[model samples]
Structures are given as structure tokens and as C-alpha cells.
Target: MEYVAGNVANKAGVRLLMACLLAKLHNPLVDVRKPYTRIGGSDSFSGRKYDERYIADFINANALPCNSTSAFLTPAFRNRNAPLVMGLELEGRPPQLYTYVLELLDDVHNRRVEPENLLAEIIRWLLINRNEQQQRIESLLKTLRTTHGAIPLSSEAIVGLIEKHMSLKGTSRIPVLIVAAAYQAAGQYLLEMNLPLQAHNAADVQTGALGDVEITFVGDGKVVTSYEMKDRHVTRGDIDRALQKLEETRKRVDNYIFITTDRIDEQVQDYARSLYTQTDGIEFVILDCIGFLRHYLHLFHRVRTEFLEAYQSLLLAEPSSSVSQAVKEAFLSMRHATEAG
Candidate 1:
């Protein structure tokens, strides 16, 4: 039972890790058992220690003769008879020794199970109870939020924001929620700049534009902005493609913002700068994880309690009668993003 509990904890930690990656949440890798960190996994074992004099004497006594490959030792004869009595057989040699060796081999084989089989069994169990496990986790989160003022999150606040500013509900709402949250916060950033928001989008609401999130400033509405939030590592190819896409929309939108969870390389920045100078009417800017968080943190601060609830809810939420390939693809993308991050 102890062993089963330990393995279940390990598997549960892995599941939480996978979920965090899907939600673009950053958490530290933690040691599994002792003094559990924010999450759990085992660290490498420490080196062994022994008494020096006893170890040296034992080694000297049992040391093999130099350059002797044929040298081997045999076990005492008293233990040999038990295997023969246990039905282990010998073909040509004396019955005792062969039987004893066979018995030892059988014992070893019976004592050890294949690791792959154990993992397969554990994963099967997880799949069977995934929904129930998620519900329990949500309940735990709710309890943590309510019982502790130190917990620092409120679903009531998140739900309020969602109800007031967002038209999203259920699983399909989350991606839109993310987009919406970022969009609303970007508006706050604009307001901070002393520019009033002339027009804005409800989360995922778009004007048939190329960007994921859009906002127009109070001034002529010609000073418009669009933000694309990609929770993944930024690459050179990604920058090039974004610049290419921005070129098409530059005639209409004044600013095209690219936000990612990756550290943008200097070369990508240089390329973007070169494009920026070449472009006539539009501004091109790139923001990394820190930058995106600076704006997105507003929503996080507002809906801290319900944020993870919303994430888990969306993860299990299905918008259609059947799960689609796109949903699986999005999850895969987030998984890769987490690994890369």
C-alpha cells in the first residue's frame, strides 16, 4: 500500500506538470518526497558512506587475482539441497548445484516486475479516473482559496470579470479568455499611456482582422493596435513569418504586437528593427514572457482565485459533440511549448 501510494503521488505530480504546461504556467521542478516543494518529483540520490578500515579489509580479503577471468566462487552445499527438493532439475551434472542455481534465478525473476508494465498500468488507471481526479483538484483549489487569506486568488473576482467583459463560458471560452484577458490588459497599458480606449474587443472578439487581440486608441481610430499572443518559444522563422503577415495588415492597423513566452534572440530583434524602418505606416514590436505577463498580470491579479479553475475547466471543457483534431493539436503545441520553456 505504501508503494502504491508513492507511485500514485508520482503520477499525480506528472499530471499536474502536464496541465501547467498546457496552461502556460511556470512552476519550479521539485523533489518528490521530503519537504514537498510547489510540486513533487524525486531528486538524485546522495552518495553512499562506509567505514574505511572495514571496507579496506573486506576488499583485500575478497579481491580477485590479477588477470584472472576464470576465477569464480560457489555457494555452500547446505543451501543446495533446498532447490533440489523444490523441483528444480539437473540434466547431466549432480542434481544439487544446478537445481540451486536454477532456483536462485527463478526467485530473482519472480521478485522483479518490468518497469514498462508498471508504468502502463499506472497510466491506464490515471486515464480511467482523469475526470474524477480533476474534480477533486478543483475542490481542493476552492478550499485553498477560501480557507486561507494568504492564498491570493478569488474565483468570484475572475467570474465577475468574465461575466462583465467576456462573452465566453465553458471550455471553448478559455483560449478566448486568454486572448480577452490579454486584450483588456493591453487596453489598460494604453490607458496608462494617457490614451483612452476608443474601441475594444470582448475576449476573442475580432473585426475579421489577422491578429488574435485588437484595440483602437481614442484618437482617429486610425491609431489602432493588434496583439498576437503565442505561448511558446520564439524562433527566427516565427519572426520572419509574423513580419510577413504584418506586411499585409500594415495598411490598416498602425501597430502589430507579437507577444510570446520565449526569449527573443538579438538577431530576431535586429530583423524586426530592419523591417520597422522599411515599413511606412505601421509600428512592429515584440514582447517576451515578462512583457506579456506585465500586461496579463492585471487579469491574473483580478481573477487570481478563478484563474486556475478557469484553466482546468477549459482543459476538460469540450465545445463540440466530439473532440476535434484541433483541440488535440493545441494541447500538443502547449506541451511542446512547456518543454521548450
Candidate 2:
């Protein structure tokens, strides 16, 4: 006799009521991408009836295709959907909730490849600009013997050009780049001076312990001068370490020079001077940023006459056997492309 909606099937009147209730309950769901103007009306009762104009327009207006920095680093290109933004956007009392949004955005934007891009661009710029600068110097060198009006090589110009293209601050790669450039410049200077270089390559600069002696010349099988490049702040402790390391090669080396960035404090300068004054048997010298710049400037002037031609020849001569791998590779690629055409 109990007439529950689900169990009362024997009675015809109760069966009809339950059928209507179930039909109403199972009405088709509304599409979220549509507009629902009327609520609890005929539209609500009807099945699968909705307008999608407003939602589509809203999406089109608000969303934009992300212009990523690097095509290779984009998440869309990697076949991944947009990541969910969890509670990381909220500002907590002590700290905020962990958010993967920034990380996600970074991957989408591809900012990680920026360094290599900048490096490649800078190298191309340097090669072209330095070549032009060398041409100007070549003209001046012709008058070197006759006139004092010859234009001087400006180290500031070179350094300024590099700084203009790339900010060396907060970059870990700048030191290595600068040191490598210095080594290249030094090798060119030696070549112009007609001195026989024992070893001058990327290996000499990159694949060694910091502060280790880099002897350039081997005359009569003895090292004449040992050079060390430091792209950091020179501390007394660093100097002590360098001096200790140099002790191992003191018998073979006649002189030792440490070159570093211009930020050398007075303490370091004083310590180096003291070491130079007190030490015997071998000469010790420190070339701070300014000193090194001046040294390079002199080298530029010394080899100005043959700089550009020599540089081009060197690039084409031995592309694989240089410290400037990126530049060399770029140049070689261009050469190959041109030849292919």
C-alpha cells in the first residue's frame, strides 16, 4: 500500500507522476559558453536550448595568443595545456602560498634562452664593428712614422660598445666572455709583435683552475711570463692563493701578472704592491680593469695596421681551433650558406 515514487509501479496514477518528475529532473544541462537570459521559465524546462554568442565574444576580447621570447621554449609548442593558477597569487601574512604561475609563465615566455641569444648577437656585432674600427686604425697606422696626428685607439670605446649591447651586471657569463676576449686580444698582440706563442687557445683560458699560471711564451724551453685573468674582486686571500700556486712554477717563470676587473679595492692593490716589492727572483704585477683596458688599447694600436685583415683570415683559417666558438661557428655557418648558394 506504500506509494513511494521509485517503488509504486503497480498504480497507474503514481507511475505517470513519477515519469513526469524524472523527465523534468533529467532536462539537458545548459552550455556554459552560452547566454541564459531567463531563469525558471520555458527555456529552463526545454532540453538543450542556449545562446553561445556572448561567451564566445568575451573569450575573444579577453584572451590573446602569447608572444613567447623563444619559439623552442614555448609550452604550447611542447604540447602542454596552460597550467592551473593555484593559490600562489594570494599574499599571506608571513609568506604567500606556493605558486607555479611565474615558473609556468617563464617557460612560456622562454627567457632562459636569452643569454645565448644575447651572446650570439653581441658576437656578430663585435665582429662587424671591430672590423670597421680596425679599418679606421689601419688608415691611421700609415701615418704613424710621419705624423703625431694619428688617432689613438680608445679602450673605452670598445668597452662602451660591449656594455651598450649587453649589461654585464648580474650576468655570470660576462667574466668568461671578457677574459676570452682579452686572451684573443693578447694573442693578436703577440702575433703582431712577431713573438712565438707556445699556447693560445680557448683551452688555455677555459679549462684550467682559477688563478692558475697561464704562460704564453716558451723561449729556450723556459716560461718568460705567466698571466692570470680574474674577472672578479681581487681579495688578499685570492692573492695569497695565487702566490702559493705561482710558487710551483716560480722556477720556470720569470714574471707573474694578475689581471682583474676595475673594482679592485685599495686593500688588494696594496697587498699586490707589497708582494711585488718584497718578493725576489720573479717580478709580480697587478693589472686592474683600467690597466688591462690600457694594455689592450696599446695592443690595438700596435697591431692596428693588420688587425682587420688578420681577423678575417683567422676566422676563415681555423674556425675550430679558437676560444671564440660561438662567433667562429656563426661566421662559419654564414660562409657555408653563402657557398651553398
Candidate 3:
């Protein structure tokens, strides 16, 4: 169950994982319990053949999001039966997922938790998560159909609209939406300013980019400005990490900005200020998330409607992991209400 839950987006070894578990539960003496079992009439004979077949068509054929693929090719999959081939031997997309699975199994093995009770609780959690997500999607679909409120026109109205989304607890990546939206809607304006915007990196993706948002020059593709986002307060330690990343990447940027939802630390601000001269004119600064959006909307007041459209587009386009289904609907609902036209 830990393995099932942890391997949310990356489902390489997952199908075979639960399949083997089910096989064991159905028949304790089944050889399919081991991933590499070559029992003549086991999986290859009983189930579908071809280890290299894709699981995507199965998911589509079933009309569900379930990912059921062969784990035989996955690194460390053959190590499943071995004592040493625990989590690290499973999947590499998420490094800790296999470890998390081991911890869950260990709890059961140690009698720390009754397998049945834990299974029941896990089922409950998964159900609730699924139900809530479905409810949100249904609600969003409802909103997407109707024109909710007047289109956001003013900077203040737009700020209030965004504030509604930010107040949505557990949607940490929502902050990035505003930053992305600003750049997205102001694409023309940014081009005029000679700061071409790049696609905002997904919260979960690592694109080897310095920040969540990077603006590069038109000709050279060198990042002119980099924006790192934090849902919490800025810290000196965070600054140290930013500095280290700069050092590691050996990339120079004219401006490096930290956008955060929480209050700025005076000491941290002072430290960030010091980086300007210390790094020979590379500006390192932190700005309030909402404040930055507010400024951008006002500065490009003519494109206020475009900004709202861009934000809505972002909310819906983002993956469920980055922006929850509920958060996406909440924004739609708020937008529908805030409109006067």
C-alpha cells in the first residue's frame, strides 16, 4: 500500500508490484510472488505475454487513470525477493518510494501494526483522497461551464481573486501560478522589455534550471532573471542554498528573485541585499508573492483580463500533484463570483 501510494505519478514498477501481492494473497504458494519467477505456467502463460508491452493502452481501455506496466525491466525489480533488494531496488524516479514501502512492510512484520487494520486504514485514506478529488473535478467542470463572475478587470479585483486561491491551504504550488500567469499574459509586454519568458517549470519537475521561472535573453538563451518560489518565509539558509545552486550551475544571471507567500525577514533581506555588490551586480532579492502579482497586474493594467485568463489556464493545466483538483475548482468558483460584467 505504501508502495502503491508513493508511486503516484511514476508508475513504472507498480502494476507488477500489486499484481504479485495479489497473487500471493490469492495463493500463498504461487511462484508469481517473485518478480523473476520463471515458473513455466506462471505469469507469461496465465496472464498477458510480452514483457515490453506498454500499460498506457490498458489504462485507456479501462477508461481509468490506473497505470499497470511490467516491472521486469525496471532497475532493481529482480531484487524484490532478496532481503537487500528492498526499496532502492524498485524504482529510481522517486528515490524514497521503495524505502517508504519497506518501512510500511517493516511495521507489519514487527507487529507494530496489524496488517488488516493498516490495510483498512490505507483503503479509507485512498478512498477519501479519490472521492475528494472527484468531487473537486466535478465541481470545477460545473464552474468551467458557466460564466461565474465578471471577468477580473482591476488590479485590486484580480489581487482579491488570487488571494482566494492562495488562502487554499495545502496548495503550496498555487503561488507559482501567479508568477507564471504574469509572465504568460505579459508575453508581449515582456518581449517589449526584452525579457523573453520561458515556460514555468512544473513544481515536481527538475529541468536543471536555477529557479521555478527563468527569463532568458532572445539571442543568447542565457537566463537574464531567475525566480525561485517559496510558500513560506525566506531564510538565510535558503539564501545559502540559492548561492550554492548558482555556484554549482556556474550560471550568471543579472537578477535572481525569491518569491514567497510569507513575511520577509529583515536580516534575510539585508543578506540578500548584500549579494548585489558581493556578486558583482547580480541582484538577489526577495519579494512578496501577492505583492509581486499585484504590481505586475497594475503595471500592465491593460492586460488585466489576459492575466486572469492566463491564471485560469494555469490552474487547469497544472498536474494534480502540483495543484490539487479542489484548488483548481476553488479558483474557478472565485472567478465566477468576482465578476461584475
lDDT of each: 0.38, 0.37, 0.63
RMSD of 3: 9.2
Count residue pairs with overlapping backbones in model 3.
Answer: 6
Model 2, C-alpha of 127: deviation from truth (Å): 25
What lDDT does candidate 3 reach at residue 299? 93
Residue pairs of candidate 2 with colliding backbone atoms: none
- Cα lDDT, model 3, residue 86: 39
Number of the top-ranking candidate, with TM-score as the measure:
3
For all candidates, the clash counts are 3, 0, 6
How high a TM-score does candidate 2 get?
0.37
How would you order the candidates by TM-score, starting with the best? 3, 2, 1
- How do the predictions measure up, each by TM-score? 0.35, 0.37, 0.63
Pick by TM-score: 1 or 3, better one: 3
Instruction: Provide the global lDDT of candidate 1 against the true structure.
Output: 0.38
Q: Name the best candidate (by lDDT).
A: 3
lDDT of 3 by residue, 128-204 (tens): 65566667777766765576453445789889878877888757777767777777778675762224223433221
